[model samples]
Target: EPEVTQTPSHQVTQMGQEVILRCVPISNHLYFYWYRQILGQKVEFLVSFYNNEISEKSEIFDDQFSVERPDGSNFTLKIRSTKLEDSAMYFCASTGLRGLRNSPLHFGNGTRLTVT
Candidate 1:
């Protein structure tokens, strides 16, 4: 079975620095998303992308954050300036079907970003 792959399983950065998290989803999947979980917080949806454009985004995805698919296979999330609040485990997910009830999302193990 195909799965999502994330690079640099762990990252440590100073506050106010920039960070880019990368992911490669299963080849056949259509919908892609980025989600995050702070150390003691719930998993929150950050943004969703489809057809090379942002489909939906949460309040957390503000001007400081951006996502792109530099290549058809890789998806990346870039934080222009990191804050202490930005420290969290970021997950990449993809689903072939549209609705949540129709298909379950396949998620990567996550890239843990630590801001100091």
Candidate 2:
């Protein structure tokens, strides 16, 4: 089965450095999303992309963050200036179908972002 794959399961960076987290979503999937989970918090939606544009984004997706489909399979999230609170688990998810209430998204193990 096709699956979402994320690189560098754990990343550590200084509080104000830049970091690019990468993911390879399922080949046939049409919708992609980024979510983050603070150590003991709920999974918060960051952004959703489809048809090469952002479909929806949350307040968490601020000026310092951006996403791109640099290639056919690679989806990337770049954080221009990381903050200490940015430390969390970033998850990449994809759905094969669009807007289907029953379409379950498959998620990667997530990249643990650590800021110091």
Residue pairs in clash, model 2: none
Clashing pairs in model 1, backbone N/Cα/C closer than 3 A: none
Candidate whose TM-score is highest: 2
Model 2, residue 20: what's the lDDT?
98
Give TM per candidate. 0.95, 0.96
Model 1 lDDT per residue over 1-116, tens place: 78899987999999999999999998878889999999999999999998899999999999999999888899999999999999999999999755655898899999999999
lDDT of 1: 0.94
- The whole-model C-alpha lDDT of candidate 2 against the native structure comes to 0.94
For model 2, give the 10-residue run with minimal summed lDDT.
94-103
> Each candidate: RMSD to true structure?
1.3, 1.1
Off by over 4 Å in 1: 97-101
